[model samples]
Target: IDRLAPSVVTAALDAAGQGTAETRYLVAGAGTMASLAVRTLVERGVAPERIMLTNRTYQRAAEFVATFGVGAVRWESLDVELQAADVLISCTGATGVVFDRDRIARATQDGRPLTLVDLALPRDIAADVTSLPNATLIDMQVLAERAADSEVVSDVAAVRAIVDGEVGTFLAAKSASRVTPTVVALRGMAVEIVQSETERLEARLGDLSDVQRAEIRRALRRVSDKLLHQPTVRVQQLVDGPAGLTYADALADLFALDPSAVDRVSAVGEGATND
Candidate 1:
């Protein structure tokens, strides 16, 4: 979106018969695209002080004043700013047309030329602005028509495939992380149970050798692991599906797993990262 702004500005200015001359600019947004537009203008030798930023929220516009070294306008003062500006680059992403013919006519009543660049989907500038002698409107349709015959240099499909793969990997890893604590807690429970049972068995069979005791403990652990294997794997798979964390919650509830145990596991992981 940022990269597209320079082309939009260049084409709009050319259509208005206005070249890249020293002129006042009113950027009708403080969003990412607006910030990029301001940066692009500054890079093209337009003084930062020549640009002004405005948004629906006055505070948002004010926040960027220091960063961009540009003046900020209150939302209510948009009309006042529009009148003073020679070029208006509007990308507010608002629902309705921000400036209609009447507003533009009033702003240009003094015979000042105003070039309006509407880069929004539901265009910020009204189509009727073209009717005014002093006002020029350049919208998305104009840009699209200009680029209709342009050549494609990048492999769009390959880029989309890479994006899709990265998004999928991110989501799967996020799902796995949510269920990891429960899995760890379940295994910890199994270990405790196996150890307790093994100790009881050893005490009852005092005649057994150390080798026999160790074998009994190993056998108990194997039995516990086998009993747990399916549910642990299934819970993880279910979380990645539509069920999400519902299955993880169910597993914890059914086993009456201690919530603190999960918290402890998470805390230990955080401590390890800090180390």
Candidate 2:
């Protein structure tokens, strides 16, 4: 929050026509958020000499002077410092309002433009301060209300789209995995049939040479592979749809495959995954 919230202050300053290099910042706290706001101001081109730091405890304000190279004002001098400031960013952990409307009106009686930012919970600046002339207030509630209309919403929509696409891809891959055991069992049955036929042919045709027997075995295996290729590919493609598991069951029934064979293949696949 220390990093993100300060950007709102910069936006408010810009909207108020408080040029970074010339604007005077009166930061009314010595906490982490306040220190970061100072750093933000300097990084955006505000002169360190023009920024002032103050806290309820005077020593707390003095401690940060070496780090930020800005003037330190005691708590008693806050109003005096406020009159000279172009922007006031108050984020003190105060129990109540630090600057009421009347006080702000007095500070801006000269009619100079002032931007007040209240980042505290109970609010360091009163809500009615906006009624004062030549003063604009941006608080937490204002930031929240404007957020949905900001450019950040478009970025958020883009991120959500990417996440949705990834989830769909993962689900499709998981669905494809469910029919793997069936495919493996069918392929195993084809291999056993090819081996048995090749052995039977060799025994019946004893006069045939080794080269002729090898050629016959290769041709039979190629025919089996070509016939099985389209069905296996189609089954895998359909498994990502609504009736995925039903297609696997239909394949098993049509082939008259033994249940034990598919179960054995499934067990082996599971063991490999665990390993």
Candidate 3:
């Protein structure tokens, strides 16, 4: 409710006139809802000194001023506050009209617009206030309509779209990353084959010197590296594109990659992540 309520207030401000630097915000209640509304105003760059709080009791207004660092108004000075305020939000639980027609009309006499946000349950601002010129009233009905049609829903939809896009991007990245484990497994298989072949040659050549063994190992390693390089590079680039999964399958098949090795690598990675 806190997240959503402010957008309605801002929508009221947008539908009405955007205030000038001289605009004063008058909140006529000191309730929780009123606090949320004031917080919204402050977050939107409304200076604390430019905001005035009024209630039936002066202490309530004073408490709000102390806590929020805004100005305070007496109950009797509501009309003067109304006249000074460019934006008026009513959260008072008054059954009758708080800012009646006559006072509103008189307050807006200087041709300045007043944005009235009525967030009361029993309806603080009169329904007839809309008929008055230069008085833009955003009551429960308007706020409901705004919640349904404009700002709030639009913003949510926009954010949801961005989230969906990011999810798709993440899936693509995850798919591209799958090929890396396959590449590592293929390299491991090559090392096992090279070691087995070296062992066989050493047994056959029985009396070979350490230097001859090292030379043979170096030549075989170079051949294996050169043979794997092109395939690994091509697969990495293609893995970022549409047919990445198919390429991974093909690589596994072509290299006769051991599925157990990839699973072991994945298990190790999962263990590391858990730790």
Candidate 4:
């Protein structure tokens, strides 16, 4: 992401009708994209003082300066920084408009053309600013479409594929774990019935010897175990495959299992994996 910012600045400069050597950059956020944009500019040989970095809070801008050497970080006099900039990238997460029409109008009044890129979701820069005489506005949608049309840059596509694969595996494991509680609950129910039936038989046949009662109880347990063996093993096997989650969900619904118990089991599994 940092590697693309210099080329973006170059394009933004050309669109604003500004010369390369004379350009001054203003970064209007301290987030990932904003920091990457600053790093990109500096790596391309722009002087630190020539880059103006600002955040919503002064401390965040200061934190950037501490981490990435010194730069023109400002929390106040935003208009002055905007006025001097040939290109500005706004990547703040603010919900409402940061740069409205009137602010852009006042900043660009000095006859210098300005290029503004809005990287926020709801947009930090207003769309109406495009109507201003020599000003240019670039939003996230334009940049994304342009990026999609371009060829893969330096094995980035391969890296993205790897990340996607890792995410899929993680999701599969999480889905498989959902059946754990249901399996445990089913076995517990089986054991409870076995104990209850054993007691009833002992009470009805009161004169039976202890050894015969013990053997009969063992036989009952074996029967229950045999009945469950195939299903439990099959469920485990099915849970590892792509269709695993569906089978797990079906098992829970068919058994009338407690949703809260399933969720608690899943949460515990997630926390253990996280650790």
Task: Give the TM-scores of the predictions, in the order they appear.
Answer: 0.54, 0.51, 0.50, 0.49
Best by TM-score: 1
Supply the global lDDT for candidate 3.
0.80
Clashing pairs in 2: none
Instruction: Candidate 1: list runs displaced more than 4 Å.
Output: 1-40, 50-157, 266-275
Residue range 16-126, candidate 4, lDDT tens digits = 443377678888988877776677666667777777788878888887777666464565778888888888888786757999999999999987888887765557999
What's the lDDT for all of these models? 0.80, 0.82, 0.80, 0.74
What are the runs in model 3 whose C-alpha is more than 4 Å off? 1-18, 149-275
Question: Considering TM-score, which of the candidate structures 1 and 2 is the better prediction for this target?
Answer: 1
| Candidate 3 or 1, higher lDDT | 3
Clashes of each: 0, 0, 0, 0
Which runs in model 4 stand beyond 4 Å of their true positions? 1-19, 148-275
| lDDT of the structure predicted as candidate 2 | 0.82
Kindly report which residue stretches of model 2 are placed more than 4 angstroms away from their true locations once superposed: 1-20, 149-275
What's model 1's overall lDDT? Answer: 0.80
